[model samples]
Target: MTLSSLPAPAAPTVSPWTLSAFWFGTAFHWLLLLIILIPANVVGFVGEANKGTYLGALTAVGAIMALVLPPLVGAHSDRTGKRLPYIRLGLAVNLAGLGVMALAASLMTGTNGFLVYVLGFLLVQFGNNYATAPYSALIPQLVPPSLRGRYSGVMGMLQAVGQLLGAVVAFAVGTLNLPVFVSFAVIAVVLLVPALITMRGVPETATPAPELAAGPTLSWQQLFSYQPFLWVFITRVLFALGQYSVQPFLQYYSVDVLNQKDGVTASSLLAGCIIVASILSAFLGGRISDRVGRKPVIYVAGTTMALTAILLLIAPGFGTALALAVVFGLGFGAFTSVDWALGSDAMPSAKSYARDMGIWHVAFVGPQFIGAPQGALLDWGNRQGDNLGYTLVFGIAAAFFMLGVLLVRNVPDTAHVKTAKA
Candidate 1:
């Protein structure tokens, strides 16, 4: 049926959001982070020889899910006209995976337990991506373009909160004892189930797909033809290259380059600084984007963060390193806040919001596919004398960030343009 055939709801001149819309952000982030942490220690302890193979294999599996599931689920949601049901399904998959992981750990010992953990991990990745694709599509629907920046800012804060909470859980559940891991799973479900319950009742108004119904059903090929959407995807992937590449190596950098006595502690402090700064900036930057524009904020953020990547290479001491962390944190926070809003603004088709968003989701997940290659580069560089690997790592990260900034120009910016309603 054509979208025009579908009944239309009263169209608001301008879209706006109440404060409660942001609650989804907090719940989504918290549960996602909690579930991820559940397997981190197991992954980390794999011997160096097999570590690369296991991680590479796992990342490939996870990245495939990341790239494929979001849009698939998103497209499904768009067709079905019910977002929450898919969200609930994804959560159930996630919870099932967590249960199997806990069960396997309880029944098996040593490497056998770890093997089951791997299976569970893959399932969790699949479920999370499926859930996240549909859930993310909700943002554009719930918050109007006029208020998207502010909404994104709140989402950013929620993301920070989720990260902090996840970190706390990881620390608390250190060593991955079977009982502790089980308890961790229980706690995650307890927290997340309620959030899902709350979201189930949040009242999403389904808009008729006039353009979508009139046109051919949304196809991947059709989605890719939109230049602005393509650029948005490119920029996001570039940004991910810079961000995720460094994340895995920071602790190693702390110990080898900074001579920190406690690598883990130092890395955590640096990460904490970045998180705190991001929380503030995301809130502030989103507000600023509302008044100014999304691109300008991203430009400033991208530039600042790119420079910080350089500073990481040159920092002489822990104090200098910590200061750089603050700078990176601020830049990253600003970027995080505006990132999604910009994506929302750049969408090619409102009728396919979830499906289009699923396409956008590839950028974040694409990194997983490429991370092994990036790590390989780091490894190759490290084999050379004088920590050249670290230099190459940060240098590559900086280049990716700059490339993202340049690509930003190609994307049609909606944050600056006003519609009749806006």
Candidate 2:
């Protein structure tokens, strides 16, 4: 069957709970690793003085693996017409990597330990990308257009909750002075349980044989030419760049800027504060976008996030920063809630959902590399005196956020609720 002759596949709607379940685990895994464990591990190995530069370099290297793996995994899964087997394989590898990371943390110290941790982190990235690339296609494959916004909202809410959980874990690690390896063990369980629930609960719909046979092989030229997808992809990258510029260094920011005695606990508290607000906004944003439109919500959300980033530069104390974090969370939650729906709507072909969404996933990881230089910049600005680095980086983040909001205007809106109402 040629593409033109293929009929639309029936959309299989799932319970919101089931639809959102797998993401909870995935979000927990990543948020814990990125926001908490990795920073702490880096500090253990490198100490506070050089943490920013080293962490940036380490993250950049790991991001290379994350960036390269997903599209390949997704394309292969599309060809095989299977997602679950790959997900299982990836999960096993991811667990093994976590174990190695725990070993590195518990046994080793200094540069050697950091290198071993890096090796383990690379493996974790590899496995995560391998699994999630195919997993990302589930939304477009399962949900119909009209319901994607609301479903994506639920997914976002669960993701926020997962981050909140991660923050709690971080707080425990900091306050109790828990062993680093123990934290890894905790994350492993947190990741594993929900993933199993999702895999068992969510059934995959088979791709029609004719459509599989007819699906065009993926090519970079074709991928770039899809205008709507390209615009969405660009916007996603911009938003992520804004986010990552600040995210990896929050521990340092709390210690250096906020003058917190235990930076880990302070950063974790800030993260918890943000996530609490995010949980609420994520649901509301998703539902509201369903009724109103994606673009308008995006405009407001992006602006709010940009302003918050700017505000963080001037926050005089942790208390004031905590308040701003709430505002930031509201914006970020809304953006993330709508982001999945936007990407799903802009997908070029249903026949290659995994491949396309895998590429879309890069929009998130690619920024880790692109913005990696912010670490060096942060170090440099501090050297110049008056804590200039934080100011410069956060300012840049605000600019990136605003530019993303502006560029998103180029993509044609595809909100189903408005279309249905019309």
In the order shown, the candidates' Cα RMSDs to the true structure are: 4.5, 2.5
Candidate 2 off by > 4 Å:
1-13, 204-218, 416-422
Quick one: RMSD of model 2?
2.5
Best by TM-score: 2
Q: Across residues 107-151, which tens digit of lDDT does each residue of candidate 2 receive?
A: 999899888998899888888888988888888777766677888
| lDDT of candidate 1 at residue 349, scale 0 to 100 | 58
lDDT of 2: 0.84
lDDT values of the candidates?
0.67, 0.84
For each of the candidates, give the backbone clash count.
1, 0
User: Candidate 1: lDDT of 129?
Assistant: 79
Error of 1 at 221 (Å): 2.8
TM-scores of all predicted structures: 0.84, 0.95
Whole-model lDDT for model 1 versus the true structure? 0.67
Single out the weakest 10-residue window by summed lDDT for candidate 1. Answer: 1-10
